[model samples]
Target: MFERLISYLDSVRARDPAPRSRWEILLYPGVLALGLHRVAHWLFEARLYFLARFVNHFSRALTAIDIHPGATIGKNFFIDHGFTVIGETAQIGDNVTIYQCVTLGGSNPTNGKGGKRHPTLMDNVIIGSGAQIIGPIVVGERARVGANAVVTEDVPAGATMIGLKARSTLVPAEDWLREFIPYGTPCDDPPCDEQGSPRRDCIEKLEAEITSMREEMALMKAMLAECAAPPTPVRIRKSAAKE
Candidate 1:
C-alpha cells in the first residue's frame, strides 16, 4: 500500500530527530506499525515461516522490533517505540498494547518437548514497557502487566501484576489500564502502602501485635484471678476463743 510506504518514511523521519518538511509531520507510528504488521502477519499465516522470519528480522533491523513469525498478533496491536520483542509461539490477543523492551519469551530450559512454549495472552491485555513475561502461561483477559515485572505463571482475568516475580495487585479492570499503562497519567487509586492492607510487612506487623496483645491480656487475667481469690482465713475463731 502507498500509505504504508509513506508511513514508514515518516517513521524514519521521526526517528531522525532532524526537522523534516511539513509533509512528514502527518505520519503516525501506530498506523505505520499496523500496516507493516499486516504484511508480516500475512506472510506468517501463509506458512512461509522463513520468509516471515526474514521480514521480521529486516523490520527489526530497521525499526528495532522483533516479532516472531509464529506469534499471532491481533489487530490494533500497538508496539510503541523500538526494541520491542515478542517470542516465537507467543499468542497475542486482540487490541493488546505492548511497549518497547517487552519480552514474551519462553522458559523451557530443557527444550526436551515440543508444545506451546511461549505465553498465551488474552484479549485487551496491556503490557507495560520493559516487562518480561516468560513460560507457557496464560495471561487472562484485560490483565495489565506492569513495567519491569518478571512473570512466569498464570495471571488471572482482570488482575494487575507488578514487581519482581509479579504478584497480583487486585486492581479493577477499569483501573488496571489507567494504573499500569506506561507513560500514561499516574493512577490516583489507593497506594500499595507498606503498613496497610494485606501486604507482607503489614501482615507480619499485625500478627506480632496480636501476639503481644494476647500475651498481655493473658498476663493481666492471671494477675486479676490471683488478686480476686479469697485469702485463706487463719484459725481466727479458735484464736479468739483461746483469747
Candidate 2:
C-alpha cells in the first residue's frame, strides 16, 4: 500500500511540475479527495449506503470535489485540481487525468430506469479544465478533451476534441506521439485554421457573386441607355399644300 501511494504520487509529479515534493502533492485537495473516495467506494460496495454518502459529502466539503461513491475509478487516476464532479454511473480507467472544473455528468432517462448514464473514459485520456462530458459517451483511449469543450457523443481513440459541442480532429502524428500534452490542446499563440490555410471555397464563392452582380449592373446600364436614346426625328412628309 505504501508503494502504491508512492507510485501514485510519482505519477502525479510526472504530470505536474509545480509540486516540489511528494509531500506537497499529498497535501493537494485532489489527492485527499481521491483518498476519501476510496473509502466511500468501499463502503458503497459493501451496501453501506448512508455511510458511503456521508463519506462522499465529507470529502466534498473538505476538498471541493464531488465524486459519487458509486462511480468506478481505476488505478493512478489523477484530478489535477478541485471543482470536478463525477456522476454515479461514470466509469474511469487507468492513468486518466482531469483538470479543474470538469464534469462527468449523467443523462436523464426517459424510461425512468437506472443504468449507465455517465461517461466512460478509457485509459490514458486527459480532460482539460471546464470540459463537460455529458451522457453515456465513451471517450476512447489516449483521447484529449480540450478546455471548455462540451462533448455529448463518443470520441474516437487518439483524437483531440476542442470547441463547444466538441469537434474531434486527429492530431498530427508528431504531436500524437508525444506522451502528454498540457491542457489537452496544442498551443496556438494566434489561432489559425486547422489546415493552416485560408478558406478558398468561401473566397471563390464571394468572388463569383461579385462578378454576377457586375454583369447584372452592366446589363441594366445597356437597357437604360436604349430606353433613354432620343427617338429618331419623325420625318413628317411635308404636306403638299392642300389648302
Model 2 stretches with alpha carbons more than 4 Å out:
172-174, 189-243
- Listed per model in order, the count of residue pairs whose N, CA or C atoms clash below 3 Å is 0, 0
The true-versus-predicted C-alpha distance at residue 102 of model 1, in Å, is 0.4
lDDT of 1 by residue, 1-243 (tens): 667555545544433354365354334444354556667778888988778777776766667777776678764465667677777788888667776788899876585885788999898787877889998999998788877888999999987777788887776556555523442212443643321324546668899999999999999999999999999987668768988
- The TM-score values for the models, in the order shown, are 0.63, 0.78
lDDT of each: 0.70, 0.90
Give candidate 2's TM-score.
0.78
- lDDT score of residue 88 within candidate 2: 98
| Candidate 2 colliding pairs | none
Stretches of candidate 1 exceeding 4 Å from the true structure: 1-34, 109-111, 173-188, 191-243
